[model samples]
Target: MKVDRGLLEKINFDKGNGLVPVVVQDVETRDVLMVAYANREAVEKTVETGYAHYFSRSRNELWMKGKTSGYIQKVKKILIDCDEDTLLYLVEQTGVACHTGNWSCFYRTLAEGDGNEIL
Candidate 1:
């Protein structure tokens, strides 16, 4: 879907910190890959290019994922929550979603039979 300016504005970008949370998921498998942040420019860039881009709060600049690490995420679809403060990205991922090299940022799972520690 082509996001018009008015629609984009309705997404309620968090300009207070100049960033918005972007949740990336694997569209086909429904596995969540990673979570990142995006500024207006990064959001626009992602829409314009069909790839994921993020605004680095640490670096204070725009950065494209997989540019240096080769873990690029290809955009499949984008959805906004009803409140429009957060975004969900259905994507095709190429490599580990976590910088720690985990398949997903959320690596730990609830142990099926054991309640002591998460898997």
Candidate 2:
């Protein structure tokens, strides 16, 4: 689902203090890559550029993924959750998605669900 600029109107940025969580996934592998925050401008830039851009809470500025690292993520689709508060970005990852040189940021596992676990 490629998003148009109009889709931005449906996002609930106010809920997250003018930011929204974006879950990035590998379009080919369907693997979760990274999670980042985005403000309205970031989202607009993403839609305009066809690349992943995010708002850095720590830096207090907008950043385009891979701008410095060259591990760019080419966005294929943008999906909004039912609540229109969160977003999922499916992208074609150029290289490792993690700054630690890992394929994904979620490499550590604190707990795993067993097959018999209840909901």
Candidate 3:
């Protein structure tokens, strides 16, 4: 889907101190890849480039996924939550989504199952 650049204005960035949480999911598998934050500029860049761009809270800057690791996330659709305070990104993931070489950042189970099992 073509993202409307004007959608940026609807995001409630101020609710999160100039950033909104973005949930990244695999388009086909429906597996949630990761959760990141995006500021206005990051969201705009993602819309402009058709790739996932997030604001790194630690780095304090905008960064495109896979800019160095070659695990780029090609955004297929962007959805805003009911309150417009959060975002969901359906994407085509190129490689492992986690830096630890896991398919997803949520590999480990935290509930009643084996904690080491990859979900």
Candidate 4:
């Protein structure tokens, strides 16, 4: 699916520092890769470039996936929830999604007894 400026403008970005949370997932495996935030400009850039772009709160700038690490996330589809406050990015990710070099950011599993198991 394609996104346009019109659609992006409709999103309810009224919550949380003028940024919307986006869940990034793998298209084939259906595994959640990571979560990030995108401001209006980031969304625009993502659609325009056909790649994932996010607003880095820490660095205070716009960043595209794989810019430094070469872990590009090619957006397959962008889904919006009913509230339009959240987004889901279905992407074909290249290399590791996590900066820690894991396949996904959700690499730890919580078991009954164990605190956290690193997968």
Candidate 5:
């Protein structure tokens, strides 16, 4: 079956670059784990394998999550933002999500009010 490109038309790539932002979150715990990018091949790879894959703009190559570290992010549900420019992946993550040994990529705490601050 052919995948629909129309479904992902709202994603914003960087300056003609092929990458789009993808946010990974824990499906059960509702905690954001990390953020990555999906190029056309990466998106197709993720859909086909049910695992998260991303195109690293910095490294200029495709990278599968947790390939070496074994901290894989399995896709549970993927949600696109209203603008279609961003992706929210409700995933089943194994072990740590970040390479830094943290549960989430968003690990820093900034000065903000009690429960509403996101970091």
Candidate 6:
């Protein structure tokens, strides 16, 4: 769907950090791919181009997922949370979602006894 600037503007971007958390999900597999943050411009670009774009807090800049690794995420649908402060990005992932080369960023799990372990 086209990115509607009007809809974007209606979101509560006024929250702390002025960014909304976006949950990326695999459309076909129903698996969560990753979680990232997106600023207004990032959201706009994602909707505008049908690609996943995020704000890199570390670099303080906008970045497209897989931009360097060529692991682009094709957006299928975007859903807003009830509070309008978060987003869900249903996408068709092309390659690894984690920089570690895993299919998803949530490849690790934390158990009560075991420390962080591979999932």
Candidate with best TM-score: 2
Model 5 Cα lDDT, one tens digit per residue, 1-119: 23456785556666588667898889999998988888878887888888899998789999999899998988977777887778888899999998889899889987558887775
Q: Give the TM-score of candidate 3.
A: 0.89
Query: For residues 2-89, what per-residue lDDT tens digits would candidate 6 score against the true structure?
Result: 6656667777774668888999999999899899999999998898899999999899999999889999999999988888888999
Pairwise lDDT winner, candidates 4 and 5: 4
| Per-model lDDT | 0.87, 0.92, 0.91, 0.90, 0.83, 0.89
Off by over 4 Å in 4: 4-6, 111-119
**CA RMSD, predictions in order:** 3.5, 1.8, 4.2, 4.4, 3.3, 4.5
TM-score of each: 0.85, 0.91, 0.89, 0.87, 0.84, 0.87
> Number of clashing residue pairs in every model?
0, 0, 0, 0, 1, 0
Q: Which ten residues in a row have the lowest lDDT in candidate 1?
A: 110-119
Model 5, which residues run further than 4 Å from truth?
1-6, 9-12, 114-119
- Report the number of backbone clashes for model 6: 0
lDDT of 4 by residue, 8-117 (tens): 77888856588999999999999999999999899888988989999998998999999989999999999889888999999999999999989999999884556577
**Steric clash pairs (candidate 6):** none
RMSD to native, candidate 1: 3.5
Arranged by lDDT with the best first, the candidates are 2, 3, 4, 6, 1, 5
Please give, for residues 9-118, the per-residue lDDT of candidate 2 as tens digits.
98999664799999999999999999999999999999989999999999999999999999999999999999999999999999999999999999999998988999
lDDT of 1 by residue, 1-119 (tens): 47667768777777688788999999989998888999889999999898899999889999988899999988978898888889999989988889999989989877466577766
For model 1, the superposed segments whose C-alpha errors exceed 4 Å read 110-119
In terms of lDDT, model 6 sits at: 0.89
User: Ten residues in a row with the worst lDDT in model 3?
Assistant: 1-10
